[model samples]
Target chain A: MSAARHDGPGTGGDAPTPAPHTDDQPAVPGTGEWRRLSPRTLLVHCGWLGAPLGSLALTALATGGRITAGAWITLAAIAAAFAVVTAAGLVRWARTDFRVTAESLDVRSGLLTRRLRSVPLHRIRTVDLTASPLHRLLGVTVLRAGTAGSGEGSGELSLEALPVVEGERLRGELLARAAAEAVAEDPVLARINWRWLRYAPLTFWVVGGVFVAGGSAYRALHEMGIEPWKLGFVRRAFEEFGNGMLWLTLPAALLAVIALGSVGALVLYVENWWSYRLEWADAGTLRVHRGLLTTRSVTIERARLRGVVLREPLLLRAGGGATVRAVAGGLGNKEENRKRSGLLPPAPRREAVRVAGGTLRTPFPDPEVTGRQIDGDRHLVRHPRAALRRRRTRGLLFAVLPVSALLAGLGAAFTPVLLHAAWIYAVLATPAVLWLARDAYRNLGHQIVGEHLVVRAGTFSRDTLVLRREAVAAWTFTTSPFTRRAGLVTLTAAVAAGEEGYRVPDLAQGAAAGFAATAAPGILDEFLTRPVGHGDRTPST
Target chain B: MSEHAAPLLRPPRHRVDPRARAWWRVQALLTLSGPMLLTALVMAALSVLFFPGALPWLGPLLLVVLVLPAVAYLVVMPRMRYAVHAWELGERAVYAAGGWFWQKRRIAPLSRVQTVDTVRGPIQRRYGLATVTVTTASTAGDIKIAGLSDADAEALSRRIGEVAQDVPGDAA
Candidate 1:
């Protein structure tokens, strides 16, 4: 393929101008023709090779001796592997080229066998730009284009490294073309507020991060042929901390772990959401730009957004804080779903609601007011008391009593210590289970207000989904033998956004049917028209 | 019956074609007979090879246990499924209701349907039967109404396609 270079001062131009290709090309300029990735990609690729070499050097220092012949051979092998990998990356960079035409974005790559991906401009749903610290140091960023399709692998196209300015211009041009309507200038919806960091530790990420760190450390020690518990320092530390009070020490150690986890959560939150900003870009799209060490910029068109989900984890809810997530299609692949779904980090519940109202304006338009008016907690219809009884019985039978009986049976069969402990465990665990069941029951609610169908449920992580009633494609009503006896049915509204369907479980059967019929008019009418088993037949045409 | 909201009781009223019961039995027999026959043969071989002198009656007893279930499944269940399987193409939606134990009632709006296809297997072809599948944007909204006559299946597919096309907006 012929490479056409654009000759000009690359910066300060509104549109990229085509330049003449020199016989001895020095620097590549921005143009509509196929262009290679920034050469700094080689440096980024080489950084991956540094870990093994650094570890080897550390091992030599720790041993404090002359390297063995085997060590020399391994070193040589590592060097050879690095060289091979670096050469591959270099060839890949050289081969990779992309062009943004008026209608589509074309990317051509692959060394041995060529592959060209052309994504039409209309189908381009999201253009995301990300830059790690190393990339930022090299003045380059990674750009990804997400298209509307199923399957995680084929939905997105990415260019690994491009000069930061070119990446920005490309993103602007693609978004401008994708949204035909003239976009209004940037109108800020939300920005970083340091006070929101308190909600960071409220997430399960803190506990999960601690567990991951501990697991990784144990794995590292195991790989080195060391039993971590057998280490003298560890044993001494545990003994000294315990001070002959094992129960107290257990709680103390847990507190220490939680404290460390909280710190880690804070650091991670700062890194990921340092400069978080949500704004309406031009006229018809929303843009989210955030991150400290690895910055990210995501732009999504207004038309693709279906609804909004306001999430409140148990702890965050207790503090009156919530997070906002967009229920939009064509934003990202399934793998990036969780990251791309987020619209606002944990903030005051009111702020989250306000931001959600702003983001969902296009989908749920209200003429009387500047901001969309969504139903608040007062409008929610709580499930009946029988639903609470169902949840309580479920929790008692499934979670609490089974474990208690097993422990008690084991204690009676074998150990006296466990026999006394069993009663305490049962008593303590029963209350916790009951409390959670009550919390879940309290959280269960569904409401249809204006043009939206709002459903809220969950104990640990409450989600209030505000979906446009018009978007609902189907309704599924399911009942089990027990649920039928209790006069309850589970109703699910199938939509094309996040989760594909949202279920409101254990509603009074009549109420659920009425709700389903009302939410999507006439869809559920035939089922309600006549009782089943009438032996009636509507003959095929 | 007094006018009241219908209780979430039984499956829907519209049943599939009556001939479906016979077709299902034949299909089940064709699909399951090979595995059942192979199992009996394997037991016979094992009796001869591994436990040559042990209880000869044990082999026959085991064979009875295995073949009895297969016989019942191939003979009885299909008829029950045929009784339960029902579908209705309503003015605005396609309703499908059925399942042996866990009865499912699904209503997919015509506006959401993306594709409709009529399929006929080899056995179905011989029996002049076909199945029509309705696919919608939501994966769970997919519906299959099987055991229709070939003519009915084609008609239903075309009707669904027409209805889906007539709807103005795409599913969210």
Candidate 2:
């Protein structure tokens, strides 16, 4: 634990480093290792300054051949520079590069400076290959690897102008690696994934549409010499009419919500349609691909998966399956450059387990699976009693909305005009705070699985988080005087990407050992002697 | 889901002190700003709520909550700032934390760290401070601690460079 080195959870076999490419990658004649040269096609495909170049070309064309030769010369120079730079970059990259023999890959690249990047055959978060309309015309794709931060984030590795076959071949190899990796652990390939094909994109579309609609509405109103939104609370006529006409308002409000919601949802749905595909199942990893026009394919290693979270809207609780995802490093949704893939939303819980045989979907972004079998009760799921307290508090807080309305109406009729609804929220807040305190005090049980630390809470919608000490990137604890005296501390443990990290609020002091065990087992805590308050200086690990 | 199963993952045994110049520049504001803010706020509160008569007590309290910490930083940092700490471990992670009074800390696992940047400001040259910013998935709040000597900053960066290349599964 002191200044010790931690070994990687092994992938067995000859999965170490790939053989360095021969001094020269043997060249083939037709469609050789490098694609044929065409700067016209390359400019349109590169994406860096495509638009500007296109605009310049249009301008030159409008001026005819007088400036055409000069334009062509300039264009050729820029294009040549792009090609030379790319070729130089490729040469440098290729010089230091080595690709794994298997699919779910490992491509290490670095020149005078070097790097070795690995994507588990079964732990690939997401792989996206795209093309602008122009790129499509040139038959090239930009392949990006994002360990999903909502599948947001520039790619870790990208191959440009690769023959689709080669790119697709790479993807296939990775998928095969994933499958092979999956087979090594699980005996199930339960791939029944229900893509909320319409949900996200619909949501995106509807929201975008609503924004456009609202802007259009505003423009239309403005053009017509009127203010649309300034209708000022309900119309005076409606306000005066009161409850008698409330029925009419009800329909209108419902209609507005539906119309806006629908248009927004549909617009969103169209923007990103769910192309959720369950590629392969076996091993400890699950391959799930989901996204819209920009598709994201992800692989979650069973060993790295954190835990299972079953979230339910009060209405959807019954036998309905749930949307599930895995927690692994650099894979969540997009937003961070470190993310290698997208967050995999797999099959609903029941079907997923049934499909994957008996594998339960862990809640945490990625759950770690010990190569050894689950020791049953030794890792029984547990919850603290305080979980119920939070639920109860939430239940009581739910009653406040109507109560506030009632208080507002009653106050307006009898109290000072300044005695407003604001006070009611404050009043309600007090109860909520008390409930929170009660909930915090009662929270208890936590379980220690093989190499994972799973914490559970909630009486209804349960939340179970599995932490993999091996994969935990960072850990910190913050304490106030009162909490310190109470022997409690809040831990902020990051799982590579902070987006899907864990914030354990108010755990007993002794749990630091357990938390540490889960965060970085065997790893000694460096901050004990070191005052870890230095703000914002990136660490080198 | 106990993390205990991963055997022992050498818990955060890495640290990388960024450039001293940037570190020092930000250290003053980060450490002193609180007290300065606390002082302004507390004084304002007293003026508004306690009335002018309570200035004596309010003034002392402000000194305790605000000036004391800042003064402590200025006094102790001459030596401690030079004691910049940076450690890089196993792979894919880096950490740097420093400051004399109100201490500063930052941790970035290479996987989540989007960018490794060194920022030099005019104030840094004046006071010998520099900052190394590690962007991550955490949003604007991702600016980790900053403040260090120029050499230490580069060294921390080089160490990160080594570890980023060292992570077992780094082959992309």
Candidate 3:
């Protein structure tokens, strides 16, 4: 909680600070002075070692009344294992040391064979700080630095269990040169609006959480050698619930699950995003700091950002809200991609767009251009009718027909009831499929706006991605036999950020090539030529 | 609407080395034959040892189902692939067009090329052929031009590597 800064002695002068002496070990052998992790790390490390040993002891107690010889041997073995693990951890903690120099961050760690890694300050694009609940209690944090152009794990330098103030100072010093012009001025872009809590339950997490909870509960009971269905109260409730009205029970159960799921989702949302703040930090970096129990502070350089994506799922869109995510490089690996990319939680559509524009330092066009002033249709170029036909045929062949055939086959093999039901199901599903195909067609649109190319697509969850034209590194054109017959091709723009490739599927072939050439000129210029009478600057729309 | 009816543009002109055709055929044989031959041999042995009655019909059926596809893969598909696979190094970018059934044409900006690797498998080594892969920062930026003569692969890699170095301000 203290905001005190601990500037390393190396930062003030070239003289190396004397290494701290442990009980028996000598000074670390190196030119640059090596600094050890805070002593608090041992406690954190011991907690990690204690979990499995505690579990084993509990299991032994549950399985037997008194200590047998075998149990005594097991206890001794557990103790030996614990001691070995603790000693190994202590050695590892002792061995790991980091030195911050003017040019690079050097970290040396290993037990027997030492490994040294040096990361240049200029290449460092992100400096992330995280603290778990226990870490917070100990006033220590984990620091990670990511360099551009490095592969996934190799690109990162992590310093685990540093004093919170020291970690903050290190982060600032590493980022100081990169953000030379930046002053410690705070400009709050967005902060947690508790009203946004309503959008939490609107996500698919509710349904997914319910299913996951049910599955885990069943597994837990089964693991304890008890059948879930044999529980007296559960069986009595199910019997009483189902006996009265068979049809109504299904909807009732669904409602109950949904209510429970919504509560779970709300709790998760609060825990993950408590006190969330999006701020413009020193030197053109966007910093997102949030969390309840385990806090995270992620800083992304604005220069690495390629674009922004505005996501509107079905329910959220109906409620006129959307979420925003950044497309940036050197943030983190794939596992952390979602958390690092998230810009804004679901909020009002206008507010989300405003924040996105503020983040990108550009005017992000609202895709929902419904009024008379702007002819949104003129700006967007939709796929040909063939795309719709293709979607309908695909739905029939891949989805509806397969289910109908299976139902009919079962009916033929077993009973006539299913065969009659199949006919009714197919008839009812045909219109729904057609509607989905039509909606999907409506969702497909691509347009070039000023310095950015906006591609809008998706059926249930509509995404409108506004990508900077200069950020696109390559263009790929794909055509299949069926797509070729329909005179269509898919054009994808490859960028170094979110999704990696943004594709516009089933565009008219010539238009796709022309669009590609226009979007990123030099890459596709060799393959494309202007048609006989067409002007060079003619807009496809 | 009129533009939609425009004729398709001619494919990139440059092709891989002429010897690449033979190399591909050998590669196809090595890759497809091993698995198919193993499966056939296993089934034949099982039938002969355990179910002698099935051996008469099973042996020929196995040959037809497994060996025929391997033959087609080793003989027919490689030739079709040779006709389809082509690459061109442009001044600003590198282009690769490949795949017999589902054709893919990819272009990677020369400035974006982060690393260039020339790989030679055992069978490819026998044919004096290699595959050159150009990688960029993006996950989808791996553009592979397979079935190049070893010398050609090395030369191409060197040339691209030099170009990538010469081009400045590639943020990555």
Candidate 4:
């Protein structure tokens, strides 16, 4: 390992040097020495016991140093379990070793079975270096190398608890193909903007976070055998709150909830994106570095990036802000993808578009030059009127009828008050539902821009996806019985990245086949027949 | 189907084997049997508990209610699916159109195909039918052409596998 450190000769500081460990990469192309993880990996593996021990200590302190016989038994069991886990960890650590060759990364592990898993270097698409607080405390980090063909479960190789510097060096070495052009100063694509914090509260977490926190806290208390509602202070607080004037207290409670949620959202925003930065690290890698407590740094190979999604939740859009997510491959499984794909936090819509454009390497027409309209506002072909009718009908059927009918039925069975409330609710909700449908319909559009197929849809979270035309792997044209009658089809472009499919819903049937044929030229050619000398026109049957 | 100027995705070149309709019916019947039996038992218990006097009339009515939808599904779904399902293996792409209510036509380029598999359920095996699934790199783009004769399915899978092997790139 010491030899590994001094393997490369020092390069001029001003020059854009290859990775510090690049010289070592080709020195021994096929054969490389296997190395074990940091010895502190044992300590990190045993860190799970800290929770039970900490809880026991807390109990002992709270109970005035009294330890029941059961507690003693539990403590003994914990100690025995800890010993077994530590011994197992040691054996596992001793058995497992990984090595990086010029062509591939190979891991050999298992005490009995003896397994060797080799992932080629070219297929490795992303490298994620994550450190929890305990890992940081132990001066180690966990590195996850995601391969291009890897899907949900088996596509990633993880090295647990490596020394921080070693993990960084390994990440650089693994993705060092185009590292020669890496400048001394990497270009910052985007950085955390304080003004964007205002958009944090506009998220669903403003209201949902309060309930989630309360629910989790209540569950935790219940798990500990304490009934929160039965507590004297809790009961008293509720009684006092109920005693206040109805309207005033209701509004005050609502205000308090909003204030608490806003504060929570702000704290979460600050903690999660404390040092958030999106940058072009090397010629072919994009890097995202953020987090305050448990820090994360993820590097995505540029070739694996399929596209960018500009996301605007209804509330966020109303506040003139949006977020950007990378539609990149090998981010990990679905859950990992969600956590790792964020390229920008909620920022001004203009800034989000700029980031998206920068990521895609195609500058969007400037708003000022494009008659003060956003990218989404131009060159988009709207869906037929039937699509709007479909949305309106669905909204009324699924959203309004269910709630109102349930309320009306309950009222009929029990009380007249709910009957009146049902009608009032219906009256209040119908317009809102209709408006949302109209907005969603208006937003439904698609365009085949140069080198990209742009599709914009969704009302709750309007996503304008700019997918690389070359990235599309397949096409799916779907039509329900209703859609068939209305002569509409939903076209989905299936790429390997992001959501796997981006849909242009409720396009006229003729338009859909034409769009698919035009977007990915060769795939649909057999199925489509255009009129002679009418290439400019939409395809005809 | 229509004499219009507008271009639509015409049906693929082939329909599934005719015995597929019968196999589908059997599959549907097998799927519905347990639920129908459970519903019948529940109704019987309800009648005994609270409506013993009305069981004579209510029992038959409940039977009709449960059997009606089951019968419709057993009859209509298979036929509708048979009518809708068509597939083709083009020189460069595999095409499949399927589903009764939500008709879908999928096209995957041979170059992008990751795997080709032929699966046979017990009922399908009894009917000598197999399903050929052509999976592409994209999760949403797998093309399944069901209800082919066993030999046809094997040939299809082998063909896809051979062609995909020759066409190379990381499918993504």
TM-score of each: 0.81, 0.52, 0.85, 0.91
* Model 3: residues with Cα > 4 Å off, grouped in runs: A1-33, A49-81, A180-186, A224-230, A238-244, A368-378, A415-425, A530-541, B1-10, B30-76, B169-171
lDDT of 4 by residue, A169-222 (tens): 677668775454654453688999898999988874687789899999888666
Best-to-worst order by DockQ is 4, 3, 1, 2
Model 3: docking quality category: acceptable
User: Which ranges in model 1 have alpha carbons more than 4 Å from their true place?
Assistant: A1-32, A65-80, A178-186, A224-227, A241-243, A362-378, A522-541, B1-83, B117-133, B144-155, B169-172
Residue A73 miss distance in model 4 (angstroms): 3.7
Across A92-169, the per-residue lDDT of candidate 1 in tens digits comes to: 988899987767889999998999999987778788888888898888889988876523548688899887777776
- Clash pairs, candidate 4, are A540-B7, A541-B5, A541-B6, A541-B7
Off by over 4 Å in 4: A1-31, A182-186, A365-377, A530-541, B1-6, B41-52, B60-64, B166-170
lDDT of 2 by residue, A1-541 (tens): 1111112232233212211223332121221112222233344435565644765655556556345566677688778977886776555534433343333344445566666565544345545555445565565455555453333433355545343334444444444434243244344333323454333322233445566777886775554334554576537656665656788877876677667767566544443335545533445455554445544344455544544333322212333434433445445343432233323232244543343223334323223222233445244322333334544454556665556666677777788552476466758666775665454333333545555656544323334455554555555555544454556555566554324556665555545545554446433343332223323444453
**Candidate 1 TM-score, true structure as reference:** 0.81
Model 1's chain B yields a TM-score of 0.80
Considering TM-score, where higher is better, how would the candidates rank from best to worst?
Answer: 4, 3, 1, 2
DockQ of 3: 0.35
Q: What is the TM-score of chain B alone in each candidate?
A: 0.80, 0.46, 0.80, 0.84
Question: lDDT tens string, model 3, B1-172?
Answer: 2345443444655677777778777667667876887788899999989999998899889989997777777777777777777877777788888877677888888988888999998878888888999988876666889888887788889999887778774836
Query: Model 1: which docking level applies?
Result: acceptable
Q: What is candidate 4's local distance difference test score?
A: 0.82
